[model samples]
Target: MKMTDDNKEIIFNNITKWLRDSNFVMSEEKITVVTSEFYAKAYLQSDHEYILEIMSATGIETRFALRIRLPVSEQQLENYENLEPKEKLIFDDKMNAVIFPQRQSINIKEKSAFLEKTISIDPKSIDAKQEVMQNISNLLGSAKKLEISFDELLSN
Candidate 1:
């Protein structure tokens, strides 16, 4: 959990390489990196957030969480006075990823509310350092698909 400079660089390099390989423009302006005792964070253009956290209990294992935050549809929002209650509240846009145990998510923001979908990973196999970097492309792909779907739905 202790984030050393070398550790931070390793994590940063992994993410940088992945973003570039995935055809995502990785410029100084779009990427933010931070490392602390408990976790390392990488933010991609403020749209994607990836974190590596060591749980309180080592037996519980370390986890990498990738969260893709996309804008909520015009209609679907975070708070409402009159609401439709259902087992699963599916958003009308790409933000409507209600698949549980996989894409666990939530909603909130201000200027434009967003739906944050998170995918958790176990990094024991991939070098712990490269875990988040390795999966970034997959994360972005899913996010891109969601964006496309949102656009499609909006058009219709």
Candidate 2:
């Protein structure tokens, strides 16, 4: 899934437009272009204070990832993973309460105060990439409502 600089640039622009269409504000400074021999990344932010990161592998890695940050913890993630009656909505202020209902997860990587879910994408085909992006955009749309709710919890 290694991507060329040109391909990365094209994808970045398309994602920018998608974010705008979603009514997210991508300030000039919030859209960062980062590239190295092993990776190319786009770090984006919105007026709502949500951040989205898109990464492409430029080395031996066979996949890219789309991730977003969430305020969550490792113990909380473990509990979510261990859910027996997953259909039940159990929320705690310390968990990713908003995303739990959607069955989405935060891949707890040294979960501190924040964690994220990384969805890998096979970037070998343009269609696959497009589909993945569309899927993420759709998910983002759905998550917006819960994100606001989570924000209120934090404010309390």
TM-score per candidate, chains pooled: 0.46, 0.44
Best by TM-score: 1
The digit string of per-residue lDDT tens for model 2 on 1-156 reads 555555555555555565566555554423234542222223334334445655554443433455556544455445444545542244343345544654445443444323233444444456754665565664464346545544544444
lDDT of 1: 0.41
lDDT of 2 at 101: 51
Model 1: lDDT of residue 146: 53
Instruction: List the global CA lDDT of all models.
Output: 0.41, 0.48
Residues 95-128, candidate 1, lDDT per residue (tens digit)?
4453232354434445343333332333333664
Model 2's TM-score against the true structure: 0.44
Residue runs of model 2 more than 4 Å from their true location after superposition: 1-3, 27-49, 60-63, 73-105, 111-133, 138-156
Deviating ranges (above 4 Å) for candidate 1:
1-3, 29-65, 73-75, 78-82, 87-99, 111-134, 141-156
Which candidate tops lDDT?
Answer: 2
lDDT of 1 at 88: 23
Q: For model 1, what is the alpha-carbon lDDT of residue 60?
A: 24
